[model samples]
Target chain A: MSTIIDGLSLGSIYALIALGYTMVYGIAKMLNFAHGDIIMIGAYALFTMMNLTGSPIVAIITAIVVCTLLGIVIEKVAYKPLRGASPLAVLITAIGVSYLLQSVAQIIYGAKARPVTLFSLGTVKFGEVTLSLSALVTLIVCAVIMVGLTLFVKCTKIGRAMVAVSEDKAAAQLMGVNVNNIISITFAIGSCLAAFAAVFYLLQISATSPTLGSMPGIKAFTAAVIGGIGSIPGAMIGGILLGLIEKLCQSVTALSPYTTAIEFGILILILLVKPTGLLGRKRREKV
Target chain B: MSYMLETNNLGISFGGLKAVQDVNLKIEKNCLYGLIGPNGAGKTTLFNMLTGVYKPTTGSFSLDGENLTGLSQETINHKGIARTFQNIRLFNNMSVIRNVLVGLHNQPDFKCNPFVSMIHAKRHYENESNMRNRAKELLRIFDLEEERNNLACNLPYGKQRKLEIARALATNPKLLLLDEPAAGMNPQETAELMDTIRFIRDEFDLTVLLIEHDMSLVSGICDEITVLNFGTVLDHGSTRSVLANPEVIKAYLGD
Candidate 1:
């Protein structure tokens, strides 16, 4: 029971971050390799604002706003011009952006980890199971955001335009959708999710560092692929399943040390078995 | 009276190859214009230029006196032009209704905000219902109302073509461009598509430019016909005159 609770908290964070990967991939058809680094930036933003204001809400808002703007700027400057270029060129650019963020962080924050005091309202216990207040808050926040995201994609006009652009950019353009604006919005939404994920993650570990986003970012990407890279629900399901599996593995004494390797093995196996991921539709080219 | 659409010396090239060149056209309001040519005679290329898929290399065109040269495809579309592909390009994963809704992107924000939509707010609900109603009306015009919920890929080829036009029409365009819309249809479907095209032209009060290889379809419906050979207009006139022109016949058949 405790393991399930713990896994839920961790999975919520992964799910939040993985949404960024899935949405950008769905609309833009290019992986934002720098997406993971946005979480690190979000963490630092939170760290600085928390120290300045000593308020959780202010810090969270600052992190979200900073990441959202950063995402839009990166997309406009780096990715926009490469819209018609080959996918390989765009991919290399994404990786370049990732390394650039890391280098910038190194210059500013240095190599040492910074300690952060997490905001805690209170804790809730349900008969023999005691979970931290932060864990409960993370789960609730993730749930609201996920539901909100689904609604945004499914019910809104711009959201429908995103799906149309993903399907056929030229066709969507012919329909009068501003493809660039939709792409920028997709990045912004994904970055906002990343900002939230970073906050919950910092709460769990109580520290921030230049490299802090790497492991979680990679894991979230793995979660996205496991669920199906372009699928929103798949990200959530894949993340929770991955969290459960990791927790279960850790519970077993002999397998605990191999959890990372085991998770990666599962990713490789899924790729081999189903290249489209769980719910991803295989593209059918029309001649 | 001014032409609804006009082009002068409109052409494009790739390196030294003049893919299309030295073409002049004048289409009157609410006219159904047909462009026919042998494969590689640049019929689709002409459509590409007019639709702003490719900017003309050396000339210009206008719609309602507005120069369309050098505009992006979407900007041109916003200027009251809409088109479908030679090959169908429906949003295959989406429902027929959703595809039509996408076509209506420019309509006022019926209901949406990330936060409001997430909460299923009243305004959002009203906007979606309005959009759905609009999409349904378009589907009805194309006789696709019954399949509104089906995935686009699941539709038969004839229906898919109709759905594509339906989606295009949802943009509320003043001019409609159809590139070989009946390319794959059977004789019966083609006959029905002809009637449907004529009906929609009148019903929607739209100017239509179409590229078709089917002589019977073109001659039966087109108000004016233009024939192209080797990137230049070979002959253009009333359907009967152009079809009777030896140059058009010779262009279709080898020397």
Candidate 2:
């Protein structure tokens, strides 16, 4: 029971981050390799803001704003000019941007892990089962965000525009949708999610470092691939499933060290069975 | 002296090949105009330039006397030009109603801010319900209201074509471009589509320009026609006269 609760908390963090990946990929049709770096930047911003202001609310708001601006700037500066370029070229540029952000952070903050005070709600005991309040809070937050996102996409005009842009960019343009504006908005939303994920992540790990985002970033991406890269619900399911598997493995002493390998092995097995991921749509060429 | 849409020597070239050149067009407002030609006669190319899909290397075009040359596709669309592809390009994954809602996205009447939508404000709910109602009306006109919740890809071939037009009309375009809308339909479907086209033109008070290979459809509906051959205008006049032209017949029939 304890392991399941821990898994849910960890999975919520991965799900939050994976949404950023899936959304950008769905709308822009580009793998934003710099997305993980955006989370790192968010963490750093949170650390700096918390040190300066010492208020959790203010720190979160500042981190979100900073990451949002960074996301828009990165898109306009690094990704905009390469809009119609080949996937390989865009992929390379995204990787380059990721490294550039990491290097810039190293220069500004130095190569060190900064400790952050974890936000906790203590614990709640239900008879023999003890639930950490932070874990419960994370689960609730994740569920709320997922439901909110789903409703937003289904019920809103801009959300419909996002769906249109994702399915057929030219057709959407013909309908007078400013494709560039929509892309920028997508990036903004994605980075904002990354910031939120950063807050929850810091609450758990209690540290901030330049390379800290890479591990979870790769793991969330793996989760996205497992669920389906462009699918929203897929990310949620994949994240929770991965977290559960990882926690269960950690509970076994012999399998704990091999958890990452096991996660990747499952990914490979999934790819072999379903190349489009679990929830991915198979593209059929119209005659 | 003014036309709804006019092109002054509009042309484009790819490397050494002139896909279209030295073409001038004068399209009157609220009129059904036909552009017909053989395969590779630059018919689609002209449509492409008109809709700002491809920038012309030479000359200029205007809509309602406002110069709009060399603009982007989105800009042209905003300027009241909406088009359908030769190949149907509906938002295949979205529901039928959602496809039209996307077309209604930029309309001032249905505008709602992202923040307002996120919070589900009263105004947002009101605007959304209005938009959905409008989209449903469009679907009803195209006889697609029954499939409002069905994915666009699941619609039948003829219904898919109608849905595309319905989606375009939802944008409230002053000028509508149809590219071989009846390409894969049967005779009965094509006949029904012709009536729908004429009805929409009269009902919406729209000026329409279409490229077609179906002579029956063209002769049955087009008021004026322009025939092109080898990247240049071969004949231009009333439909009856242009269709009677020996040169126009030769260009099409290879006589």
Q: How close is candidate 1 to the true structure, as a TM-score?
A: 0.97
Off by over 4 Å in 1: A121-123, B108-119
Q: Would candidate 2 be rated incorrect, acceptable, medium or high by CAPRI criteria? A: high
Q: Rate the local accuracy (lDDT) of all candidates.
A: 0.89, 0.91
Error of 2 at A268 (Å): 0.6
User: Which stretch of 10 consecutive residues in model 1 chain B shows the poorest summed lDDT?
Assistant: B107-116
Provide interface RMSD per model, one decimal: 1.5, 0.8
Least accurate 10 contiguous residues by lDDT in model 1 chain A: A116-125
RMSD of candidate 2 to true structure, Å? 1.1
- Model 1 error, position B30 (Å): 0.5
What TM-score, to 2 decimals, does candidate 2 have? 0.98
Compose the digit string of candidate 1's lDDT tens values, residues A237-258.
8787788778788888999999
What TM-score results for chain B in every one of the models?
0.95, 0.98
lDDT of model 1, residue B91: 93
Off by over 4 Å in 2: none
For B11-48, candidate 1 gives per-residue lDDT tens digits of 99989999999999999999999999999999989888
The per-residue C-alpha lDDT of model 2 at residue A206 equals: 89
Q: Which lDDT tens digits does candidate 2 get at residues B1-71?
A: 78988999999999999999988889999999999999999999998898888999999999889888999
lDDT of 1: 0.89
